[model samples]
Target: MTPPVASLWRRLLDWWPRIARILTLAVSIVVVVLLVKLGRGIDWREVFLAARGISGPTLWAAGALALSGYAAYSGIDYLARRFLNHAQTIWKTLAIAAASYAFNVNFGVLLGSVGVRLRLYRTLGLRHAATAGVVLFGSVTNWLGYCWMGGIFFFGAVPRTLAAWGIRPEATRAAGAVLLLVACAYMFLCATAARRRWTFRGHPLAFPSVWMALAQSGLAVVSWNIVALILYLLLERQVSYPDVLGITLLSSVAALVAHVPGGLGVTEVVFVDALSGQLGAHEVLGAVLMYRVLYQWVPLCVALPGYLAVELRARHASCGAGGHDLPEEPYER
Candidate 1:
């Protein structure tokens, strides 16, 4: 590439994250202001009563689902740690992941997964290379499951909610099929190319074992579906599970791509837009609020103190810039 062109590309890459964050923050603020204006007409008493009317058994089910989903979320990092061959204890790794994930759910990746995980992992003596590996692997693991699950949902059942938007079911099914193909391709490559090294732009590519790849996809699907079931139960099963799961998968991708902190305003908007066909806007918002309380707010309340300890440890860091605890060739095959 030409010098000017290459420099422009480099600059764009550098500035992209900052630009995305600013745009996401602005969108979130706009959504909040709109909600506040609309809140004037909302019947809080009714909403509260509706939530209160839920059976105790259903509430217990939601709590169990939340805990299970969280455990599965932490398992993504567990696999990453194992993949990196880090010596951190399983409990320590899960704790860090759980805390960071809580922050990620409420805050953005910058503060939660990227920032919090970076600080906590460093204090445990991991170097930059190993830390990056964990982050990358965790991401890959989550996406692998999302694609397959999304594909299945899209192909197996057309979302009645999306039909209101004039989207063709056939088109949705085709897109889902594509996702399935991509998912299958990844597994095929892993099974055929494990331990093989291929380099791009001077950095080597690594593939985990097929079993590890399967584990990643399975864990992610489990985490995502449990969360969806929680929302479904919150909505009193007004919508079909397939419809809810499909929308949930789409929202997960949107939240990640938009980098909307905690997905604060983003998730509600998406849920209302798609789910309003089956449930009233007030009902949709109510269910989302309940979901937020369980999935984001409660965990965030706990993660705050845990992250505080992480900050304290960061002040007296035990980590090294040099690959001290890392293997000589740290990108494990």
Candidate 2:
């Protein structure tokens, strides 16, 4: 409580945001380097041949699965809105959710997704608190679903994958147990502390009801599974579904931890490392490339124009209304 100590703490708090940004940038660079090193051995000729050999029907199926996956992901936003008791048409929510996710997958969540969501929600007339609530709810739901599915998959169905990764079966099970425990803890909190609110650094945090959490988790699981299915279809179903599921889960976790843009190289590196023996490196690389185009690039192409149109309309409205722009709101640090 002394003046000198208080001054030191205040200075540290002021520098925290800059420090965090620096750390994130450094980590992203490291991940990109690792990805390049991991991909050095891949044969592009084979990769291209594999891509070219993919049947039209298979490509169509993968595209359909990709669409379904994004649609399921949009449900996260819908559930978040419900949790916050915000009223918006499902169509509008879906539009924002799809566009934001497309941006997030390409540009990273912190830089693009959150900003897009905040702006879109504000333009839709929600206050800052509601926007933050929606973002928090969506993030929690994603983690909850990941833990639930990952715990189940790693604990029982994919011991071979653990062995391949040089992880002992016992250790893998223990890790799985830890994941399950974290998910269970969240559910317990929701059940018993639904009305509880906590303040952290001047921001209020609230828990959704148990049923809402369950719904959120379910939707996330569906979205993730659909994504796995897309990859499986792209690979011509050569690999077993369980193996694909495990690999997808590992890659997803790695990309999330790396915080790299679009998880670009992180995912491909993990996939190649994990499934090299099960499938040819070039074939796997090709399938991954195709999957990215459908899931990330295609969505991004659609989202960018939609976002611009929205911005243009907003600008025109502001100009018409006495030529003043809307006030900018500060996003959560």
Candidate 3:
């Protein structure tokens, strides 16, 4: 039997995750409410009309871009699993990832992402310790990709933005250098982790081959840039590839911090700040708001039905004595 203090500690530790989840939910709700109140100028009728005006071809192209991004993400997972020698089915991987993204779009990204990975590995009959390693590797690799993209954009684009804001060129260069160093440091750490087989909580994490990581990273950047271009096209009635890339990178970096659901307020603010010079204030607001409705919410609305359909079918396939079986615990993975 455990001592009373030890038992108390254990109980707290057991409930800690649920407590964290509840706090996240509370924060998400509050932030969303505040953002909605602040950005309340959104004209629902105008948004509706604007959405209707989106041409079928344009919608299709946007969806295609999104699908391409999903595929790249799934591919990254597959490669990671392969590298780890986990040997899970590709369809299982894809479904789990799709569920993850869908959950991320609805719930907060961190919880949804981890939850999806937990379930995916559990369902695939992977050990909890191994699953933990896979999740850690995948996260670190994806973030390395993010840092690389952000670093390139910082060096190539941010100095210009800063210079345009009347900062001295030398100052801008210095700032860019700092950003570059940070990004490089992050990449170095990730590389070290991958090469050394870093462990988190005693679970050894392994990354895919370097070439595979880089290829997936490249695809992720391109896929995101394409989505940004679509939004730019919709808003400005034109697309600037450079602007799209820069804004995409900026928004991605910002999203990591914002922690809002789907990076809601944070992404819009970053896009507006990045594009204000080219598009002006009102247009930036309008464009970002409009982009959110279509590129963010609308797709979620559409995809959710498909997700539900898939889930229901899956449920039906799993026979039970009386009712459906409950999902196993995360620790049971």
Candidate 4:
């Protein structure tokens, strides 16, 4: 090949990943814009009135709860490290946590937590395989919490409510049956992995004590539920906590099933539909959108600069420049 042609080909190869990221970002931006536009002509006055009705105390209390949720989220990795017996520091974990969440919210599964972990693995001194294992176990733990929270309402509340809503009891029963089978399959996989003594680079999975794990998961669900309630309170005058919790939990589960990026329209639709009898369509939509913006984007906005700082420092250190010494390998799966 000619020298110029070969040089151009190498340059393209090097730029490919960056190009792909840019494309993904562009698509996400377009999706958000389209969804917002689709739900236009919203009554701003009602939204503003609802916002005004949200008591100052409630807002403050909700904010505090939301912050606690963030703490719990950061602790996910902390517990994972403790369980895995990795000697990683908290600061590194904090940065990776921020990056992973920001990426997951914006980019969905393609650039989910796994991607964030992969990018920050160097600082953690983990290889790809080890990092994958860490991410997998963390994901499983997180999902267990999600299921635990959903099951509470699903069994105790959803079934009764669905019947009241005129949904056939047999339909709910069928759904439960399907979910049971799925859960069994998942448990089988985890058990199989456990039996194999699978470890990324032999870093044994230290399963967190069941009680502690349950507590962590429970706190996570409550924190998130508070976030959801805050949105409803800000956008509607009358919504009981139990109602909000039930609606939020069920809708969240459904949105996950739809698998849309950040569950975008899917979540909003579910919220509005569930609350239709009590809330005007526009009011619910507005409330959900506002909450989505605040809960979903605000944290990432706060974390972005910190993540960038970490990345820059890691790069400089690796080049033997101004950055501090840090490991380059990531955990293996």
Candidate 5:
């Protein structure tokens, strides 16, 4: 090859990953724009009115469900600890889980969530590698649940859902089959090779036992259902539970794939598009707004104070110990 041609080819190879990332980001932005335009005709006044009309009983029910959902989220940490055979206290696990999730749900996962978890777990005397294992285990737990429940719902209820969106039944069934296959493959791996470990970046990681994997998947499904119930309650019980579950599952996948902060614009777009038939645009928007406030904002508010307290105690302990290092702040990264 000529020198210039060889140089150009090497440059293209070097830049390929970055180019692909840029293209993905551009596409995500366009999707958000189109979805926003689709819902632009919604009446803000009606949305506010719908929000205000939610009864006290309904609000209470939603709040209770939110609590249950978060409790299940905390259980993810417990399950991770059990899988690792770590002896951390229940209070510590719950505290770290709650605070980390509160941050992650609003911010993107890698952007903030894992950092918060690492900091808190370190404060509780977990080493860096062990902390990473916990984070990995928790993440795997979430995806396992997503795949298992998502596969079931997509195969059963969501084909009808796609039909509403004008998608062909055959295509929808194929997608569901793919999801189920992936879930089954993971379960098979756990059953056959649970004791195998892999190393990444100098850290060794092991898969959970078959029973533990099933437990993790089950906890994740229960958590997801509770969250969906919260949304259904916020929507004043107008939409059926199965529809809400399917929509929520698809919306979450969209948000994750889009890589948007908190899946902010992406989630709104998916929700409006999916639920527009059962509820008016304004009503759907209102329910989403309420769900965000109750499910995301409120938990974050409660968690921040707890985080602050942890930091203050760590600082105080560090000062008294004369030369001890303190846990890094969540914003350091």
Candidate 6:
């Protein structure tokens, strides 16, 4: 209210974004350091042996599910392309999406998902801001689903491991209530916000329709469930799906917050702790190892070549590199 205080407040507002990034980077460094220390405490030989104990059939099944999960991920971008009315073929959209997601999981967002998508989408005719819009849409859509699923599961069936951390069911349920409220608010905005748009830096993105919002949430929830199912199957269903799903979702938070690639060691540590009551450390680590192979590495291996090939083809094709391939409507400012 005072002029001096208001000036100070304005300066703080201007500096907040930088302050947040620095804080986030510091936190990620701490998390990664802790993860490294925790990782050293494990007996990797036992983890490897436990992986060897897995049956071939289960491995094959997990592989199949991984494919399905990746396909669903690509579907997110397909929705984005449609939302943007971008004139691109389905196969190309899928290729870019799949490759970007694969990178995103294996690398961090900037290095993998966002970077890969921006590069390939540019080759496919999207401008920088247009690609940013697509990336923003994909990001928002995923989190909406996460909120929906997290709120439902946390409220309905608190993770068994929460008790270990002295976290009360009531607390998680309260958190779930909050998450659900956020999801509902997004839905309400989609329905009534009337062509609302968000701008960060110079890139502006429009909100999807209510139906598209629901579709995004539905697809994302399924994709996330399939991820949990992969781990469950690898563990031979020894752990309850809700418990497994709860841990899986929680791990995503750690990785996302820390900006770790594919969550790397973060996921293994979280799973081991959450399921310690039901399984040995080795068993959990083994399932996680198999999960990394099937879900992350294999996709990365395939995607790398696919990405190079797409880039090569795009370079040879008669089109402006990094220029719009199609006439895109102006985004609402």
Query: Would you estimate the TM-scores of all the predictions?
Result: 0.82, 0.85, 0.68, 0.69, 0.85, 0.85
Residue pairs in candidate 6 whose N, alpha carbon or C atoms collide under 3 angstroms: 125-325
Error of 4 at 14 (Å): 36
lDDT of each: 0.80, 0.81, 0.60, 0.62, 0.78, 0.85
lDDT by residue (tens digit), candidate 4, 1-333: 699998998899999988867765665565466457546855667766655555666566656655665666667777666666554577777567656766676557557577767667655566656566568766766666555555554544443335546777556555555544544444554546544554544666434454545555665566556655676566554666666766676655555544577777766665665666777776676566556555667777876787677678777777885445664544332
Error of 2 at 67 (Å): 1.3
Find the candidate with the highest lDDT and give its number. Answer: 6
Q: What CA RMSD would you report for each candidate? A: 5.4, 5.4, 8.1, 10.6, 6.1, 4.3
Candidate 5 weakest lDDT stretch, 10 residues: 324-333
How many clashes would you count in candidate 5? Answer: 0
What is the per-residue lDDT of model 3 for residues 1-333, given as tens digits with 9 covering 90 to 100? Answer: 369987898899999988877766765565566557546655556545655666677666666766666676666667666666665667877666666665665566565568756755665556666566666656665665655555565555543444554657565446557656765655455566655756655865444445665665675556556566767666645436666666666556545544666776766655555565775445555556556655557656665676566556556655652465545434321
- Give the Å shift of residue 126 in candidate 1: 1.7
lDDT of 5 by residue, 183-278 (tens): 788787788664566565586546666888888988988988887888788888888888888778877877776776676767667767777677
How much does candidate 3 score in TM-score? 0.68
List the candidate 1 regions with Cα displacement exceeding 4 Å: 1-41, 313-333
lDDT comparing candidate 6 with the true structure: 0.85
Considering summed lDDT, which 10 consecutive residues are worst modelled in model 4?
155-164
Give the per-residue lDDT digits (tens) of candidate 6, residues 240-296. 888888899888987877667788888987888788788988999999999999998
lDDT, candidate 4, at 36 = 75
- Kindly list the per-residue Cα lDDT of model 2 for residues 155-175, writing each as its tens digit: 775446557879887877777
Model 1: per-residue Cα lDDT over 1-333, one tens digit each: 799998999899999989988877776565566567656766877767767776778788898899898999999999998787876678888998998889888888788778888777776656777777888888788778878898888877778776876889999899889989988988987887755666667987777878989999999999889989999999888888888887788777667666668776667777877875577667777787888888889988998988787666655442543434333323343
Instruction: Give the distance in Å from residue 287's predicted Cα in candidate 1 to where it truly belongs.
Output: 1.6
The runs of at least 3 residues in candidate 5 whose Cα sits more than 4 Å from the true structure, single-residue gaps closed, are 1-23, 35-39, 194-205, 326-333
Cα shift from native, residue 328, model 1 (Å)? 14
**Candidate 4 regions with alpha-carbon error over 4 angstroms:** 1-41, 44-49, 159-166, 173-224, 227-237, 321-333
